[model samples]
Target: MAEPGRQEVVRRVRELLARYRDPAQVDGLGDDEPLAVLGIDSVTLITVAAELHQRWDVTIADDAVLDPEASVASLAAAAVAPGGAGDRPGGRLDVVGMGVVAPTGHGVPALWDGLLAERAHRLPMPYDAARGHRAGAVAGASAAEVVAPDRLLDLVCLAAGEALGGLDPGRRAGVTLVVGTTDTGGNALGHALAGAGDDQSALAGWVAERAAEKLGLGAAVTVGSASASGAVALGYARDLLLAGDAEEALVVGADTVSKSAFHGLAALRTLGVDGCQPFHEARRGIALSEAAAACLLRRPVPGDDAVLGRLAGYGASSFTTHMAAPESAGIELALRRALAAAALAPGDVSFVNAHGPGTKLGDVAEMRALADVFGDRVRTLPINSVKGLLWHCQGAAGVIESLACLLSLRHGTLTPTTAAEPVDPQWREFDIVTKPRELADARSAVSVSCGLGGVNTAVVWERA
Candidate 1:
């Protein structure tokens, strides 16, 4: 009663299930066993689809494969059908408002002003003068001023308050907050433990809940990792929008510099002696910084500040190639995939916000990748790294860098890559915009970030 190729399809499905499932949990899975019944979560299902595509060059429809009744037999049958197509149910998503707490300035307006003026916010550490770690710190009002002392929940609450600004209460209630960070309250708790020999700061989950409560939202989620956390949060928000799970999502990426992180980077010799000077021949390394970046995503509404841009496409890749080095292949794949998804060529991108950490090897590798991928286009497009102004905010850098891209799109201007007095020889082919350039018809831009553990992400945005 089965179609001609149904058996082969079923065989492939069985193989995938066997590979993905725990041998101890499921002794053997039958063709009719539902995927959920086999204990597969959404992320795992996505991974399964990716694997299947790579193996068979067949795409699985999320709607069909995600059904509760979806089974190996059903999926195989669908895959075998010649004309069946996967259903992609999400509608277009847009970015309406962005809130930033960065070293150059706080809030969107101040940040934009600083970027346009080409001012460097890099300075000596303001919090712990004893550490003597020069950093680009947020100006005016410490985190303590906005958040209560010795409380992680209070920090989230305060950040949410500052981010919400003037949003309507009804609208705010419908918006969900998605926080991204590697260590939410670890620094505060570490200090508390050292000072009093007791663990007292609220946990990360409580902080998320408190943030949701402060924002008058129904739910909150937290994403953790290194640089990819912010992009991952944005990707998740996009999925929520497409799935009709939420009308609006507030994505926040925040992280403060900690002694552990600072010391670790210092030990690795990646900390810059001077301020961060990305893509410059004289570049030393990165300057660790502290900041938070938040952006509001919602359906397009009329008269919304002409929307700097909408997040067009996102692509990510992770590699274990190097623990402390950058991978050109991974970076290239992520950028190429992102560009392909956006249906744009390298020439279509007017500017790039590079994840230049200012390390000699890292910057060279990134430049080589760009040259390999874009070739002649590399020389035509303007490129810069905001780390020179914002320092390296770890998990927060991705979102803050994205905000900078949005600002460039909105203001029709490109901020120069500061301290890049003399461009590196490896980047000779690329047009390194040293001073602010007027962005005439520059509607789209790309932001690229690579993290430790070999995580690479590229996000494309188009003027709305």
Candidate 2:
């Protein structure tokens, strides 16, 4: 089913808003007026959204529901609500190719080996002392070795090159590019401050532009929702394809170690000095890593060997709960929505690639969310976190871990989490795999990401 026209959407939104406001207030409400200023609460907005979803059968993101500036017209424009959660804006997008450059290794083969071997490649922290003694720096690569002024951009090009290599040149026409990063060229700005380069090009916009130019792709849209940036970018690209706005999408996620980023994490006390120990009783916090990962997505082609897997479903949600701490309700909503988007039941999910930043509160919140959504099925669900092995790659972590899901679909094995023993008693019902486990007949996986500003995202992938 197609989404309603802009006019219809606007009319429906305005009609709903009128029910909550006084007739005078409704009459005075301008299209640009802030809903909050007019005494509209979040619950009222959510109620309106629920009604709209029931009416239009389209998926409306929680971010829009909680947005402070949400007005009737803007909400209508953003919702485009076509089919409900059970309906995908577009059909499944095939992941034709993937590439990764991480602290564990570069390229898919090396990455798979390192992950299956459960290796934690840590290096002495080179940035801020407050970030701890060890960090996950990409092996054998420095800022000077890359052609781009920013190492982050260089990583993007490198990973994109690999993913694009498998794509036929004839199929590259009008390919949209989406880059995700929290510190988009922030390190470049640091160098510009030292008078080493043009300061203007060091801005976030230039990072996306330069990366798209370097990769011979279209003007890039960058997503920066902290750790959820990659997943959000993937979801955004999927929506574009579904909406017929683009024929193809090259989604890239990259982040490099920076003093500012380190200090921020340090301020939050989320740096793991010893190492990331997800779901463990003695878990400290995240071991920051620099990584770049890319995936090429397009409409599925019959008998295409290059097709790695299908992006079966994706969902995103944001809460006004807490800045750094995660809320289980938001996480569960995203997960349930993604499953609905995929048209899959909780029992169908083979395993989960969790965010698991190894923080005290963050890990517990995720577990509770998983338990909430999966219910008794949590006891058998093989949930694992790669952060203990590859460390948290920040903005790039989502796609990097997503690639792990594809690899699992391809290899029929579930990678283990490192040092996950002495499990947190709170989640004893959950199976946190610490050793490599064969997938057997499993054919699907879920990757969940939660970030600062109460951002949450989930993507479900099925073997293609």
Candidate 3:
């Protein structure tokens, strides 16, 4: 078969681009203009390229699609090039690196060591709610100190730089940054503005840009979905790679405990006076913390060197449940969607990384969802949450927890949930992995995240 001419390519590309937006949004769009000028955002451009690859039986490098000077005509030409035909030649997407800043410590090793030891790093909170609340934090950074709005950028740079470490500058430019963050350093920025006046203000909210510069990357996208933000970012990264939008994608979930969170959680009475004891019969509420988690993902070339593990599947679901509570239906739907995406079943899952935050309602809902979706297997299948140990990292919860799953896949050891109170009698069927257990086959497990506003997400982790 012969390649389609430029005219045919242009027509199809235009038709596709138009589908993403109303005609008015691209009123002045030209075949020779950069797609961005026509209001086509990076995410939309990625979708367009993926569709082009799938529909036209062609493959185009991500940069070509993102090139500003290159017009629709040029992109069309590249798509129909003789070498462009066919699905991308690769195995599957894999998690290559991870970086984390949790209460346990910074970096992946610290995270693993702390988790294995089942250490709890609580912030020492002043009894005076106005002063602060919690036990102690890692590296001498109390939750109060770490949660300062200004510390968010510090966390992002620390984690992202680690994730991209040892990568030559050239490789960094080829990677796209997808940052999921709930803490945006707003209070810090506002204070700075008040001090310096408008003319002397710093760009406090340019987090993604600052992160890109710190990590030597070209661009970044910021995703926010409350506690599920990090997982949502991971979901986007998976699609970007599967669509050939980038050679690699870096996802960061970072959030600092802010004054607002403190006040709100305190008011809601969700702050556990002691450390978080998830799913305990005497469970209180969530213990909020400041943290950042990062993961680097790449599509695998056949016979590639190696990877930590493969992010086989991810799915998210939303339902109009109360903002402060979770509904089992949405949680189950998200889990089933992820399993189906991986072509696996509940029986195939080795274990579940639950979103158990210890809240009476949250834990109960998640447990019921697991029992309903996995059936009697819930009685024997291992399920646990890092929240018992890590505190509630909020937006970073998803990313850090998912990283735990990847670690288990690599080490063949299923980490245990910290020993909390006994299981709530109403939900005794679920097998909470309360003690460190070695997995006979840690090949596949699902990591879950329950967020405010009914946002729920799940990602499938598999052996590389």
Candidate 4:
């Protein structure tokens, strides 16, 4: 079913607000006036939201929007909020919770075990030639198949439930939720459970609302920037917390194979049939994949800093449209911004999670950006791409790989790229860790993402 339109959402919220108003205070009630001033309390707000949920089957995180000082109109807008979590311009956020839904398994434990074990979950393409355009190519496989948007919500719930299980539902509801996905990629995973084609883009709000409802969370938004959607969303989440809008946020990035996406790759003429050889001399191109992952972000508590990891900094850049080849300047722009935000020199980076799509242009452009960011130090850092194992997950790529980097930090393991293909003997600047390396001094790491439409994003994660 199509999601409720914007007007419908606003109208319904206002109607609920009016219904719950006290008769004594209804004399001159104004929608733009603070509801609390009109005698509305938290319980009243929750009651109205519950009624709406029962009548419309649209769950809501009422507490997040029902601030006593906020007007009825503001509450209505919050209910249907749209945008990244980082609404503010500057500030750093920390990660406190996380969820994972990848082919290797579900939950953080599965993600960690799979990466630490160095297992590849690539599988034969399930889409037929008519649908996928290619019959025998490889793709990333999840634990189960998602038949509809509702089922996709089920997968998101798995990852989110685990990450947020520790937080009180009331507290969780006060935090924002950001759902990230590319223009067309995540239709395959749990990301775009929304209907396909034109409806997909707008449905991000619908998906975010549903996911928030399931997680019992509040203010929600959707961000799409093609492949960098997840990473960009994470950046926004950080900003939202720094801006003091919410105490925490849940950011999820998911993607799956779709006819439109598969066909798009086929036309690009860079889709690899065998495997992704990221950064290798014999690299072909990206292999498609599906996955849904989530992270919980928040400002550090003064007395208790119980955090999974620290999202030190994030930067996003766009090179606009590039017809002939990928651009490196956009990546360099994001890298520089991320470094500055993190307050670290490029040389301090302990590890690198490269956005190696295995495409000739994509890989080289990323290499160039790294060289520019770290200069001579880029040659020695242990760099690797998870796409070789996880395949290209479209927008979800950033979150999935970022989680991998976090796991590496927790386990002191550096994941390996595919058995080092032929060396770029001339410019073998990158030390692609071909095998798992025990990282003793793993303090800070970086995750790189480049999307179609020239969106490049870099996020720095630090061990707290």
Please give each candidate's TM-score.
Answer: 0.76, 0.83, 0.76, 0.73
Q: Write the per-residue lDDT of candidate 4 for residues 147-183, one digit (tens) a residue.
A: 2334345555667787786787668768788878753
Single out the weakest 10-residue window by summed lDDT for candidate 2. Answer: 141-150
Best by TM-score: 2
Candidate 4 residue pairs in backbone clash: 86-236, 86-237, 86-240, 186-255, 188-256, 188-257, 189-255, 189-256
lDDT of 3: 0.76
Q: Select the stronger candidate by lDDT from 1 and 2.
A: 2
Where model 4 places Cα greater than 4 Å from the true spot, the runs are 1-91, 129-151, 183-202, 320-324, 426-429
Number of colliding residue pairs in each model: 0, 4, 7, 8
What is the C-alpha local distance difference test score of each model?
Answer: 0.71, 0.80, 0.76, 0.70
Model 2 lDDT, residue 293, Cα: 92
Candidate closest to the true structure, highest lDDT: 2
**Model 4 reaches what TM-score against the true structure?**
0.73
Better of 2 and 3 by lDDT: 2
Ranking by lDDT: 2, 3, 1, 4
Superposed Cα RMSD, model 2: 5.7
TM-score of 2: 0.83
Position 80, candidate 2: lDDT? 44
Candidate 3 stretches with Cα past 4 Å from truth are 1-91, 126-132, 142-149, 193-205
Residue 139, model 3, lDDT = 49
